[model samples]
Target: MRFMFKTDYEDDIKLFPHSGYLWSYGSLLLVLMIAPFVLSSYLMSQLVFVCIYATVGVGLMILTGFTGQASLGHAAFLAIGAYTTAYLQQFGVPFIVYFLAAGVLTGIIGAMVGFPALRLQGIYLVIATISFAFIVEEILARWESVTHGNEGMRVKTIQILGTAVPRDSPAFYYLCLGVLILTIIGSLNLLRSPTGRAFVAIRDSETAARSMGINVSLYKVKSFAISAAIAGFAGCLFAHKLSFISPEMFTLQLSIEFIIVIIIGGAFSLHGAVLGAIFVVMVDPFLTFLKDDIPGVIGGLAATLGAGAQKASHIQDSVAAFASANGLKGAIYGIIIILFVLFEPLGLYGRWLKIKLFFQLFPLYKRATFKRQKIYVKSERNR
Candidate 1:
């Protein structure tokens, strides 16, 4: 275990609090840089998705994690970015310019949503955001002239510096990784700034923040704008990565997955976003494997239970069909979210922190060190 005693105020806010962090982070970066060369093509593709999802996860982390606000419609911002990029690419606008433009447009839209949010809180805010998402989806589907409606739009290869970059190229992977790295750095810096502090203040206690002379409403709006902008940027990358876009791609299920990403990874930490993204991407194959094997397992069990071979086979086929359906993925996501909320409220990062601390302290570690504490208020007790 390494120990460092703070010698000055600056140490409190230092990005790397100790040399140990620098070494660990540097090593991780080195591994990621070489992964493309070593990993299979399928794994490389997964990593690309990890980067894209991490970008969106970080954006949600800013709004829901840092700012104590909830949005169920963030996928709408992603759709906006994706569609904007798709439209602009057809008109010969450079990727860089239109990519940033998507973020700007989505940020403006987020600010508009945030205005009504100033008067709402908790579940009300959540409902409003959900409504906003549905509205955006409707517009996208109805605006057939621009969005091509439900038929979807095909995206051309991204042009960077006058060279066409295919989505599957290593260069494209690096582009995503680069953007994700920049976003992580930017989020870390934002957290270290006064605005980030204000966000936390609002999250913890808006009344206390207001008493401290912070403009609670304004900062809330700012957080929404920043979060939406990041999501939009991620969406732009996602559009080019897939080379196809449609209204169905950005649905309520996608928004819920974003929320699940932060919840399972560690909603309050920047590292949680990346970790959650990796978890989501990496676990998908296992889920797919399970989906494929489940029918065989069911068939064998049914046969052993004295069912006729023909009946067992039919049952197995039906079960397999249902398991292979698109709803299975959504069901899995729902179960994960529920399980994480009920049992691991602090998320995977929180669990990792406990393990790290346990190792660092060794025999001195106590179970109660990480236990959740319950507060009982006299007023609520009486009620």
Candidate 2:
């Protein structure tokens, strides 16, 4: 009945918790079962967008979250994927070939970049990657023959095995959901394997990992390649979903957004990717709608209160007006990131884990300390 997974530790030095296995799988299954019924077409389409974004976010999580590499050029890899799909489709290639090719091509490019770039770390690495992102974008935008340049390209309705699936159709939503599920499950499985541990080891300390005989370079490149492949897979799906292709679709802003999703969700936790995607995409629209709709009702109430309420109405109007301007979205995201880093660096999933632990411990919660020692509980006890 417990909701959180317990981590093991040796003495005082703590390690990451491995709790929430059942809840993770169960929650996703429930969402998949009910999402079609609960979400309207507009919302469903938005959810598709979240899924695509989460796919890239998951990739970044593996690199940034697990391997401790910061990459601001993830969307560049996505662009590679999107353009690859678009170009291959133009040649009458089947959807399957295009999808696989996008992932493989990006993975190869990522590995090549990772080898040289791993020589740098921290801000320098970030700067290098950011430069790479802009470079990829410029190449895609200026290389007219291959990319069609800024003119962009339009993708036809995606047909699989000669069966066409329209963008807005429920079928397309289901397709996205299926991809999301597969990626999540695959990520979870990978994280449970030796490879995932190696990535985590490298993240914690490359020197230590090397001392422990964990092939640091191989894992580092592997992490980037894998992350790029996942991002590419997302792009393939995205090209079909949008039914159009452009460099604008893969902006630097989006690359930052992907990093935000992982940080807000919980770095290194796949579930964080899901939660962050749902939170960021869903919350923004709801906040926008509330800002637009609530003022009218508030204004009506202000009229009843007469002249004294005039001041209140003005204040409310100003606030509402500001919220509707779209600038607030960035402001809110900034605040969220600030608060999470300061108060919950592990992200929302970290907060969720704490909450679950609180309920699990009940009256004993008051004595519970947020320390490394708690991670050492028996696995049998957790189960």
TM-score winner: 1
Candidate-wise lDDT, in order: 0.90, 0.83
Could you tell me which 10 consecutive residues in candidate 1 have the lowest summed lDDT? 374-383
Q: Per-residue CA lDDT of candidate 2, range 1-383, in tens?
A: 43444355332232223335467767867887688788888888888888888888888899999889999999899999989999998899998899999999999999988998878999999998999899999999999999999888888788887899898877888888888878877887777778998998887767667779998888999999999999999988888887788877777778878888998999958889988888777876778677987776677667667745777688678768876886677787789889988988878898888897789787778533655452322432442
Question: Lowest-scoring 10 consecutive residues by lDDT in candidate 2?
Answer: 9-18
Candidate 1 total steric clashes: 0
lDDT, candidate 1, 1-383, per-residue tens: 87679888899999999888889999999999999799998988899999999999999999999999999998999999999999988889998899999999999989989999999998999999999999999999999999999999999999888898888888889999999999999999999999999999888777778879999989999999999999999999999988999998999988988888899999999889988998888767977787789889999999999998999999999988887887778788878888988887788998899899999999999978977576444433442
Clashing pairs in 2: 5-19, 5-20, 7-375
Error of 2 at 303 (Å): 3.5
| All candidates: TM-score | 0.92, 0.86
lDDT of 1 at 177: 95
User: Which predicted model would earn the best lDDT?
Assistant: 1
The lDDT of model 1 is: 0.90
lDDT of 2 at 191: 76
lDDT of 2: 0.83
